[model samples]
Target: MHKQIIFNLPVKDLEKSKAFFTAVGFTFSQKFSNDQAAFMHIVGDDIRAMLMTETFFNSLINKPVVNAKEGNEVIICLSCESRAEVDSLIAKATAAGARIPHPPEDHGFMYDQGFEDLDGHLWNLVWAETGV
Candidate 1:
């Protein structure tokens, strides 16, 4: 059985992507990082994300890269402890050169904010009420 999982994402610039994610509170694993890719540690058990340069990622896959800005291919969602935490991350990301795709929205049960990373990848930061 597999004990660990890693999600690989194609990026335009390795350094920029690393800097952006770092600013948004993610630490990288230097052991897996190099000029071509960076390993970002997500806040979960046995989960890591790899940010690979466009050329490097393309060399590994036959399919063309998804234009993340043209449309939504996927929405990476993360759960935060509080709404303030969500806002804080959004602010930090924006300050680090990420683009705000939309304003924060409240749905009573959940609060969500979105930002586009340096490579146009969309990330949704959410805080959901778990108590009934």
Candidate 2:
């Protein structure tokens, strides 16, 4: 069975992407990070993201990269402990130059909100009852 997962994404500016995610309350692993790429730690060491420069990312994939700002590629959804946490992350991301793509949603047992990062990646923050 697989024990770890990492999502590789292309970024125009590594430093800016790092800063945006940092402001959104995420930490990075310096051990796997350098000039061309940043190791963004999402859920400890088990699940993470590699924010790479356009040149570097292009070399890893054979097809052309999608412009996230212009079209939909993938939506990264994260589970939050509570609705407050979801809202807080959205607010922080907005303050860090992220664009709020949609309004918050409430469905009795679940709450959701989302923001677009500096590189136009759509990240959804969701809070749901654990027992449900």
Candidate 3:
């Protein structure tokens, strides 16, 4: 059985990608990171995101890399412990130059907020009221 999931994403600049995600509170795995790629460590899960440079990443795939800011591909959603955590991360993301596509939405049982990273990757921060 598969116990872990590692997602690979393309980035234009490795250093800038590192800084952006660092601001988002994710650490890097030095063992899997180098000049062309970075392994972003996601806490509480074995799912790590491999941030690879466009050229290096393209070599591994058959299709060309899309311009993220111009086209949407995927949105990475993270579960938060509370609304406060969601708000805090959103602030950090915006401060780190991420653009907020829309304001946060709150329902009786859930709250959702998100931002687009430097490379235009959309990340959603969500919180669900426990016991729901």
Q: Which of candidates 1 and 3 reaches a greater lDDT?
A: 3
What tens-digit string does per-residue lDDT give for candidate 2 at 15-98?
Answer: 999999999889998999999999998877788999999999999889998888999779999999999999899989999999
For all predictions, the C-alpha RMSD in Å is 1.6, 0.8, 1.1
Backbone clashes counted, model 3: 0
The digit string of per-residue lDDT tens for model 3 on 1-132 reads 997778888998899989988987899989889999998888646778999999999999998899889998789998899999999999988888999999999996999999998988888999998888
What is the total number of backbone clashes in candidate 2?
Answer: 0
Q: Rank the candidates by lDDT, best first.
A: 2, 3, 1
| Candidate 1 lDDT (Cα, 0 to 1) | 0.88
Model 2 spans with C-alpha error above 4 angstroms: none
TM-score top scorer: 2
Better by lDDT, candidate 2 or 1: 2
4-80 per-residue lDDT for model 1 (tens digits): 77888998879878888888889998998899989899886577899999999999999998877777678888788
Task: Give the poorly placed runs of model 3, Cα more than 4 Å off.
Answer: none
